[model samples]
Target chain A: MSENMGNKVSLELYRTQLLARYFEQRASDLFLENLVKGTNHLALGQEAVAAGFGVAMNKSDYTYCTYRGHTHTLVRGAPVAPMLGELMGRECGILGGKGGSMHLTSVEHGAMGSYAIIGAQLCIALGSAWSAQYLGTDQVTTVFFGDGTTNIGTFHEALNMAAVWKLPVVFVCENNLYMEYTPIGKVTAVEHPGADRASAYGLDSIIVDGNDADAVYHAAQDAYARARAGDGPSLIECKTYRHQGHSRADPGKYRPKEEVEAWFARDPISMYRLRMMENGFTDEDLTEMETEIQNTIDEATEVAKLSPVPSLDIIDKDVWADGGSAWRN
Target chain B: MAQLTYREAVAEGIAQEMRRDNNVVFLGEDIAAAGGVFKATVGLFEEFGEKRVIDTPISENAILGAAMGAAMTGLKPIAEIMFSDFLAVCWDMVVNEIAKARYMTNGQVKVPLVIRTANGGGSRFGAQHSQSVENWAMAVPGIKVVAPSNPSDVKGLLAAAIRDPDPVLFFEHKSLYAMKGEVPNGEHVLELGKASVLRQGDDATIVALAAMVPRAVKAAEILATKGIEVTVVDVRSLVPLDTQTILAETVKTGRLFTVEENPRLCGWGSEISSIVTEECFYDLDAPVIRITTPHVPLPSSDNLEDATIPTVERIVETILKNMG
Candidate 1:
């Protein structure tokens, strides 16, 4: 396949990537200013990967993601209002005010769910894919994880099952180089975490520029096509970085300023905007898009703040069978 | 009606389900060509082929997780975790994901998955492999826990588990695999959450589960020979425990002795004792007695393991002491 053929990200995809960055930045600001509680793992630099994967899939396809999942949720068309409302702990949240930021789901749009547990979504995603194939549905399940998650045993186990059973799943490894505070090299001896490992299980694996939205999108598209066509599962490792700390609290004192700035130079949102302009987006059009995103963010925040907190009865709810009756019983 | 061993009954139940529904599949470490480590899935691969009976990698988490996924997608998947002890490896999938998916999704999703594993300590397997870990499953919500002590119960309960809309953990005692009993020649589906009275009497009640049911029966016979009547109740399902039957028996007999193979502290026996004490305290002639394994790791030695577990000798003595 040619490098650019069927690999070029469309203008609409570019807007989504830009909006992901803008909304996450706004979320980070609101969080740091004490306007938001709980934790927030901003998908700042990794917007391209989420946008790319979302662009290559239909709404009917399934997606399961990790805690740092704001971009993935948005790209899957989770209304920004519910996303902000979730961060604000409101009744209007996506999970009906049950699951907070990390735990989000929109079953109608085929967003199977996103989990907070590290490497937990891997098995769940594989399960969903098995369900799709068992039910004879064309939908494929894509699970996104960080480079740190590759070190987990569940990741290896999940991949092996997907390969052995030939389940319809696309293992998206967004290698952000850090599993929390520690770097990937300190943990594992192997350099290419995803590239060589998938071969051990006879999986068709590939490495792509995680920052380049189009590359991730095209890789996902090929993998999805294979999965939908019953060619088994594939692992797509996208080398990327996290622009913010692992969580809302960490100031990222572990990283050097020069390294942080070097990564900032490759910010996915800016690159996508530049590409959009080069592809004939006027300055006025870019300005309008930016303003439109800002307005949406503003409206979302306002609406979320007024939304009611989950009812007091919900605290003991959804934890068990029969509406969590067993909890108190 | 043809007689069948507990193992054959379970295997037949799975086969019948697979034949009825194309979406029903079996996945485990050696369930496919190897016919399962215990041969519970023997001849299934020949009948259903690879797509249905799949031998997965040595990953308990993957096996259950894949089953959960398949169940979520509308497939009725029966995943075999070789031993109840190994269920720990996949607890996150079982307890967190499969058990909680229905309620978490606000009833939008249902994980119609069955995780079958062998429990109990009669095989003299070491502590790791011999534990009767039914309490852990009972503690979790949105998941039904069933322990079938006989061949007929195995066939009936397994079919019910497959047909149920929620996730079910089917615990078949490893020692009872070869035990033979009469079963209906045709399909038999037992209702879950209902306990069956194995032997009827009026003097006292013996509530037991899985392997302990047979032990309780022998204890009842000994008590009868001593001029004491004893009722033996097999508390099959643990999660939606048959509290009504237990209460009724306890109220009628005015005496109760619960038996289980697990550790004494907070064991299933302890739960039964508590329930009987709380709901039928006035009806009780004496405090509920519990005959359970000692609060220690299962010893590997034959003599030590025998001493640790609750036997008919111990159950008879406990019932006599409680009745007196």
Candidate 2:
């Protein structure tokens, strides 16, 4: 736990982390039951990183993330029903099921969009930050991606431009040790994929304990303050691990058993729960929050199940602003 | 009315929008102080100042991605990709990100930005720097593609693209930048998806875009002396295509000839031919002939480049042969 974080903020972080954890667990179960179609990238063990940034960020600040962004979207205050419904391909989904699991977006809540392509949102997020800076607004833009994205070209392009322009943006790299099936270290030259490259872009190398919510919150707060104060962009590398596979299809058999168990012992949700208790939170207080989160997830799942599938009539709609895909007029 | 070069109109068009709306900002490499590599965007930096008219590093992906982000937020940005051929460097941003952002989000986001690139061949800059790629933007579902033939259309269409609610790719022909024509005094915004009939005739209809439009018109003039008066239709915008004007002219003349600067295979003319065949199949007096450059990379040598692209003589000869 950090000294700067108040008890109330810590509890809120704990609650958000619990919400993300429970929601993803239900989402996984729904995927197994065939209620969720296509493929989904779950963020089961990376709750602290999402919760930390989510709680610390201002409501107006924009967020961009990769395909594994369910937790990021939830932390931005998007209702779980539409998010799960989107995964279920229902009309009531956030994007009306037009953007499947990989492309979740809720612009109204400042959760810009989850890009399926690696390192794409990195460049896209620059525009939002540029908009803020150009308009003279204090709104900061934060973009999150996995460790694998550090090798992509856009990562370098975006970082260079952001620094040159001195745009108010923060780049967060959630290094979950694995990029899809391959270990990130195998392909990457540097030990810290994101942090190691920060000096080249003239940015500070910020490394955080992503498993600890307080540590993440402090890091996020510092980055946001620097961005708001016109200090350009900051790259923070968070060391975390994902409990599940890259997607629903793989079982992640490539990883050794000992590594999985060791990561499991330092589970973000369990660690946060213990931290809350150490901060004078009663067992009843924590249990009550957990029960509430479970009920919320249960209700969200039911709502998603009841939501109807999108109709074929809208197949050609929304292609243009006029609500029709008419190329020749 | 004022006579302006196509390159000067590029600057005027952007300056007009920036003057009207504070949200309108422009960015690209050497665009601000240097006034663009082609010198087409001259005076934008001086008039709008450094904040509104910014310069960027040579990062196509970042340029377009940042434009998309700015457009979605509040600012209406105009990003220059230097050359249309360089769009390949940022194809993912244009095709996967900018083009699909609106539809993928179910219209929750609106990317109202313009990507201005110097397109087409004529300067003999070689295949890498001189390929015509309007068809690339046209194939994308959400993007609006506009290619103007003359200075007046450049100002009008560029202004219209800036005001459009969707992402627009404004293709300024590298060959026509030096050409001069009369433009309206102020705020000349033309509607997209509308073709301009440069010359009217009943014998035959010649359709062209960008650099080909002037060549097609010259071909019509030469054919007029030979008593073969053909209607010249300048396809100003490709996406949201003016099919009605194209079909009407084709049906009126009972013949259609497309002068395309792009390569032979799967060019914009192919789509026009298919549409005409489906709609005006019976109205045609002869098969639709497309006067196109052969499928090959544009060479740097002036002789090879001129021979590669469809010339005024080629259009005239092709039409004269096809009329028989």
Candidate 3:
């Protein structure tokens, strides 16, 4: 279990976690300040999964996620500027400012796309995996979903098909212990859905401490290797938690204050940062990284603020690839 | 010139496109071994092999969803839905995802997928197996709905839809699959929005689509025998309707009849009537006529089902009445 033969993975984890933390904290502040409008699902406490898996993933590999995708986008190499511009509804955003926070994409970085609809990306990712295999490519796709999505029909169908076809996919379950407000225990009778069901499909699965960046990085490395080798799909259940409420508007009033405080106690970013220091990272070295990230985010925010908004004239465009024009009217 | 059945032409088109591009592949129920229930994809499995001509489980949603994903990732997929009526089960995959993904992504992604299915009422397959649902797809944005009535049109449009960079719902009428037509021997492709005039006349313009084209052709023959000339227009594609030709014909004839096998209310005929009325109101000499099935489920009995859908006799009688 302790594959910590070196400190390289731990350092990379610290880097990603740092990005996720600063990114979400800035987004949360902007949302509260009314600069960032619309629904914002901050991946505050769940930075470890995105950063850890992203660090463990190859450049050719792909990642698909649910509405909590800002962290995924940033970890997958999306520039902070265009992403911030997208969040601000600027034309230079990833989705051309059409899709806000919920629907963000940077296919060039191997992040196929993200969707707001729960469990929708599962089937889409499976299809992409199928394409990869059919085209005789070594690329693999990692599809991330919440514990709540495991109950959806698409989740079961996609998994079943992926298993039968042995698609080059790694299904990642970011079990943050809550789907909106409902707890995992309240919904699923099985303690670990990903691992338990993966065995039924004759595929390998594992449960890892999602907060432990090294653990996620190692597990993801295994899954990605198996998928790229055409050995079929693997499932990883990352038992993590979201530090903030599901969206920015809610205060998570349904859960007790102590529970939120309890999760906040095991903050993935702070834990990774401590690990970085323990591994001989100097205070000045950490400060330089922090300052660099801050300055980059500042420039991104400025670019997003100045980007033009898409006009309504072109709103009716791109409805169809050909000039057939389905939504012209 | 070569004579081929509609199903044969469709399979030929698939084979032709797959031969042209390595990125083109196909999948559907029994499409591999069984060669499809209608045999539209017959011999494709052997020719293309399992990786290209895949036989998927009886999950319509998975088949369509996987095809959409494949298309997005750089492959052109031709998916078979068996029958058009089963589209109801996979509506979410077709309408919500496949039809809207390109637009939703602001054209960043191109879902070059063709959903080929047997449509229209014939062979007494009843309401379940036999029903025209082209209108349902035409209502959705981001999708090109083309219903080919003849073997030549099938090959041309199927190739065109496969080559195009959009999600196309290509409906091959169940009755027309076996109907023979003269098709060119060499490669041929049809444009999506162009309508082909089957026959020319001066009294009235008879606009028809899919299976109704043959019926309207017969009606035009009858109208000619009675010295009442009727123009017949086959609308190859419904979504991007050939409004230019339709309006031109309607303006010259000053009378029109829209024929379809779907229900009369909110059918493609209704849309044609609305568009014609809006654009050619000044040239109208008589109210537009629509020949469609009754507002009821398709009957199981052959005679009963035939009575519901527009027929050659029914079309001829309607045309004569409009001539008044």
Candidate 4:
């Protein structure tokens, strides 16, 4: 299928992708230079996705994503300074420096949380969607997870429950084709992943070229609409790839060099940039956008670096909400 | 005040909270039409309907995860796990997700979910249905565990757990469902982490939990005839333990005995024993004795099952043995 689904692709969407790309790029530099001070998995090649679905939902709509969440959060309007500050373990971070890269959560931005436990984020997203319906709110929640999560028990449990209850949720499988350096083909039996599995739950599912921001936005819009209309849950599997390795430490040497090169050539950022140029955007216009994003990220990084590390006294705090605790000892 | 069974009290507790707070809802397998296998949720389905009293598919893990998710949002979800043995199947959801959310989020979110599960033996349902999971609940952090012995405590704690700003594990003994006691009419919300001293004595302090509370009470009656005075303390809440109440009683008595239905090794008694020993080490006149079942799975046979659970006879005998 062509990247465009007959709808006019917005330049604003392209700008969102650019912002996500720049954010991930800066994070990469920070992680590589050891300035971020934590292990992280950067969503390098997956810029279109982070921006596509991020901007597709309304402000009241919630999101639940995997550990590679900075790009998703940035595109969803989470403040860069606080997010980066969180990465640096500063008190000014989004979670007050408690949740680092893998566990970022923003209630203001409707980001429920990012989880390191494989399929947990997706499962929790169903709960939020159930809450929306239970409380008579039309707000929908989009659960983003790697295709690798589809094989897990939580995926089946969540999808089954969402289908039965008619939860306002859109399950987005960002199939990056790998699960921690292992090919999905080796680990998974199903070729279509979420698309194939969703049928078992009597859910409508679609496959999208995840590199195309317009395609994801359109798919997400349809799911969100059906959800808001009380039509129950659906699945959208986006075929994408992560540009970075599984984590900061690994070089992803297991992947064939040719495969990496092929994916690198079709980098979502460059493709979107090319599409913009063809659509009457100038080199100077692109440069201005890039420079502006760079400068903003630079200031954010500096602020994150300067922010004070979280106090150790708060280490024992927040265990319970009623000033009671289970882990005090 | 009205006399009601333990199951009736629990059902009333849920119903009263649902009436008071629109945010409170119920979800469990067969809890709607069947009124729960143990009938702990009887009449709630018709009173609350499908939205409030939801009958979920038989998925324990999903129930726990979804409840946490709902609690993090606006709804105060009371999820019924049916049996406490199934709790081990979804232990990750309890220990990892429910227990760690608020702390990991730096207090940004609170999971006010009440996980109600049938616990303990004596109904002859075999090992799976017969488990006292206070040890499991108390072992986890960021979770409040409540196992009320009588009808009154169940009613008050159920309402309290729904209103609590944290997650709670409400363990219900299978045998105690039909057990009757006087329950106060209308909004009765008990404070979590407060112990109820059922019987007052000065010779020794007996900290009893869940089903063991009633057993300890019976044991106190039996011990009184032998010229031995025993104080039976019902430890209503395990996680947010009322250490002050327990400590004061232990200091007054100078001898303490922890009673639970769980295994002796790494059970809730060990934690209580540690607390009393650490706090009242000098006040101790005798070695703190823990009365618990042997570390073994509950058997299916009537005679076998009887040998595993803590009983009044066992409590009385253990108290007598410890006194010397």
Candidate 5:
């Protein structure tokens, strides 16, 4: 994959990364202003991971993400208005306004879900992969988790099952360096948290410099091809950094200011923009992309605010698929 | 009529379902080639092959989540948890993920899966393996709980459980595996929440669930010899408790006995007692009698463990004492 602006794919890759950045900025501003209710975890520095996976995956492929997953779902093509509506607690949100930010799901786009529990999505992704295998479909499933979730038991269990059954799945650990304020160095024993564990399951691990969208996209594409070929699951540890605190409420005082500044210098969006410029893209072209993304975000916010909250008459709605829930009389 | 053991009945139900629907698959530890610890899933691996009859690693959490995902993606998976005591291993997947997915996602996903586990303690399987956890299933919402008594009920209920478009916990008693009875021919599917009235009488109503149903029927027979005509009602499914059958029977005799294998305090028996009391307290000639296992961990010793569980004599004695 060429990074030069002469390649339309590279331009789109830059567009995706920027789209994530602009969306995060808009979401961050709205959340800080108290317009977006609940605790929304932002993916400011991890834009390449979500966007690159978006670029690499096939339309039929499934993606399961963590709570910091607005970018993941957006990259998977979830409706922007409903995604924003979810943050604003509107009835028209992706999850009917019940799941808030942590549980946005778009089954149509193969964006399975983003569970709040650390390693829970691992099992869910493995299950879907098992389904694809059992039904003899060529679809591949990818699960995104943070470095913190690698410590969870389900991570090992899901990987083991996937290895044993040769399930068509990819375990993508976005090494954001911090597991919810506690730094990875303090808790994890190995330098490569997920890659070290991959050998234990008899699978090879692919370590990628996560800041580069091209690298991640290529790695994920390779994993998809391998999985679709029935070679079993692989672990891709994307070494990335979290720009903001874990959530809106968390402060970044725990990190060394110098380390934070160094990581910010290698920011994925800025790096991609420079590559696009060197490849002969004009400043106006980048500005046009940013303006278009901003309009999209703005319209989503407006549409969400215009939508009414769900009616009280249907308060006990959707509790059961068979309508057997008796929570309300 | 052919006599089918409880295990055979369950296997038959699964086989019939698999034969009927290609999506119905059986998965658990030792269930594939080993054919389940109690042989309940015997010959299924040969019949359905490895694809449907999956042998999984000893990871309940993964299996439960896998079953949920498979169910969501067009497979009706029947996951066996080996023992009901092991339900704790993957409690969150059931209580939080599977049970709450439908409601949390606003009914976007229906958990069309069944968790079948061997329950109860009659063969001295010890504390870890011998728990009757019907209360645990009842405590969680958005999931159905079904415990069948005999071969016929097991066959029907297991069939119904796999086909239901929601999560169902099918508690099969290990003690009743070898217990044989006449099962209906061919395909059998029972309703989810319906209860079967084994016997009818006016003196009193005894509500028994799972393996306790036969014992209650025996106690009722013993009571009849002593000039008592108590009705024996089999409470097949707990979550959708057949309150109509229970209410009608309890209202007829004005006396109800809630019997189960769980411990006495705050168990499913108490839930039934409260349900009857709240619905028709005035109709009761006596306080609802709850004949449950003693509040103690099951002992491995045969005699001691038997003493902890409610016996046929104990049920007869309780019925006689509670007689108005």
Candidate 6:
């Protein structure tokens, strides 16, 4: 935990972490019931990284992340009902059911977008940073990706360009150790997938205990400050673990039992909960917070279940700014 | 009116928009100090300065991704993909990100940007550097595809594309870069989705785009000597196609022949042929013929390259053979 963080900030982090954890839990349950259609990549064990960055970021700063971005979107203050409704493909969803779980976006809240293509957002995020610099705004752009993305060409291209231009941006890698079904270490030449490559781009190699919210919050603060101060980009690698399989379909049978157990023991939400109790927080207070999260999740689930599927009229709508997909005038 | 080369028109078009709106900016590989490899954007860096007219590393993904992000936020960026063939290098950024951002986000984001690339194969730069990939852009939804034939259309159409609220892929034909033509003076902006009828005749209507327009026009001239007068229609924009004009011209002549620089399969002409067949089937005096490059990679050799793409002689021969 960082010494600079106040008790109030710590409690808020705990609440947001719980909110993400509970929302995903409900989402997992809904997926089994066939309520949430298609595939979903939940940030089950990576709540701290999202929560920390979410709290640390300004409302004006832009955020671009990968498909594992439900937690990030929620942390940006998107209402739970609409987000859940989006997963359910309902008309009242955040994107009006146009974009599914993997592509969650809220431009109004500065949550730019969640790209499914690996390493693409890193390049896209640079544009927002460039725009800020060109328009003379102090707003910083942050992009988050998985450890697997380090091997992709766009990652290298984006980093090189971002470094050359000294764009106001931060690249955060949530190194959960697995690249879909393959272990990242087997394919990667470097030890630290993201951090080790930082020096190559004229950036500091930063690695943080991703399970620690305070640590991530402080790291995020430093990166954001540097970006806002026009000191160029920073690449941070958060060493974390995902509790669930890559997606809902996988059972994660390939992993060794002992490795899974070790990661499970360091679950971010539980660790944060215990730390809160040690710092003058009661079990009752934590339990009350959990109950509040449960109620919010319950209400959001009900609203999502009741929401109607998108109308057929909107199928061709939004293909252009004219609200029609007509190719011929 | 000032006579400008197609390459000069490109710089003028970008300069016009950049001067008019502060939000409009230009970036690409060698586009700044080097004035673009094609020399199309010369003097832009001196006029616009470094902040607005910027040079980027040879990273297609970064160049386009940055353009997309800028467009989504506020700026109307004009990004050059040196060669149209290079679009394949950053296909995902162009198709997945830039094209679909607006639709996927339910209009929360608008990518008001132009990806200007030197398209087509008259330079014999081999298959890698030369390709008329406007059809590739046309196949994708939510992207406006424009390929200007003349210097005048280049300036006007490019201005329209930059001002458009959606993403536009502007294809400036490599062969037409040095071709000079009179450009309308001052703030010229032509409406997209409108085809230009460069010539009028009653026997047959020839539809062409970009480099093929000049060939088709020359073919019409040569065929005129043989008493087979033909109307030439330049299909300027592909996505928001001017179907009404195409149908009107085809219906008037009662015969249609499409001349395309793209390969035979799924070329822009195929779409026009399908449209003409569906709407003006009864009005046709003869089968709608399509004159296009054979389905093969453009060869680097001059003779092979010239034979592959539709030439004036080939267009005239095809028209003469099909006009019966």
* Each model's lDDT: 0.84, 0.93, 0.85, 0.85, 0.88, 0.93
Which candidate should be chosen as best, given DockQ against the real structure? Answer: 6
Clashing pairs in 5: none
Q: Write the residue-wise lDDT of candidate 2 on A1-329 in tens digits.
A: 34554987988999999999998888899989999889989999999999999999999999999999999999999999999999999999999999988888899999999999888899999999999998888999999999999999999999999999998999999999998999999999999999999999999998999999999999999999999999999999999999989998989999999999999999988998888888788899889988998999999889999998999887899988888899997
Docking class of 4: medium
Question: What are the DockQ scores of the candidates, in order?
Answer: 0.44, 0.87, 0.52, 0.61, 0.57, 0.87
Give the higher-lDDT candidate: 1 or 6: 6
Worst 10 residues of 1 chain B by lDDT: B101-110
lDDT (Cα, tens digit) per residue for candidate 2, span B241-266: 99999999999999999988888998
* Candidate 6 off by > 4 Å: A1-5
- As for TM-score, the candidate ahead, 2 or 3, is 2
Off by over 4 Å in 4: A1-9, A323-329
* Candidate 2 clashes between residue pairs 3 or more apart in a chain or in different chains: none
For candidate 1, lDDT tens digit of each residue in A1-329? 12353324566577788779877987888787776688888888999999999989988888989888888988888888888877777887777666667776777777777777678789888888877777788989999998888878889999888887677899999988887898887887688788768888898669999999888888988999899899999998999888888897787889888988988998877887787677666778778878888888889888887888878777666544345545212
DockQ of 6: 0.87
Clashes of each: 2, 0, 0, 0, 0, 0
Using TM-score as the yardstick, the better of models 1 and 6 is: 6
Q: How close is chain B to the truth by TM-score, in each candidate? A: 0.98, 0.99, 0.99, 0.98, 0.98, 0.99
RMSD values for the candidates in order, in angstroms, are 2.9, 1.5, 2.6, 2.5, 2.0, 1.4
Question: Which pairs, if any, clash in model 1?
Answer: A127-B69, A128-B69
Q: Name the docking class for model 2.
A: high
lDDT per residue (tens digit) for residues B57-153 in model 6: 8899999999999998999999999999999999999999999998898889899999999999889899998889999999999899999999999
Write the residue-wise lDDT of candidate 4 on A1-329 in tens digits. 12453323556577788777777788778877877876988888887777788777898888888888887777778898998888878988888877888888887788888888888876678778888998899899888889789988888988899998989988888888898888988988788887988789997668998998878888878888899999999888998888878898888988899988999988887887787777667788778878887888899888888888888888778888854444323
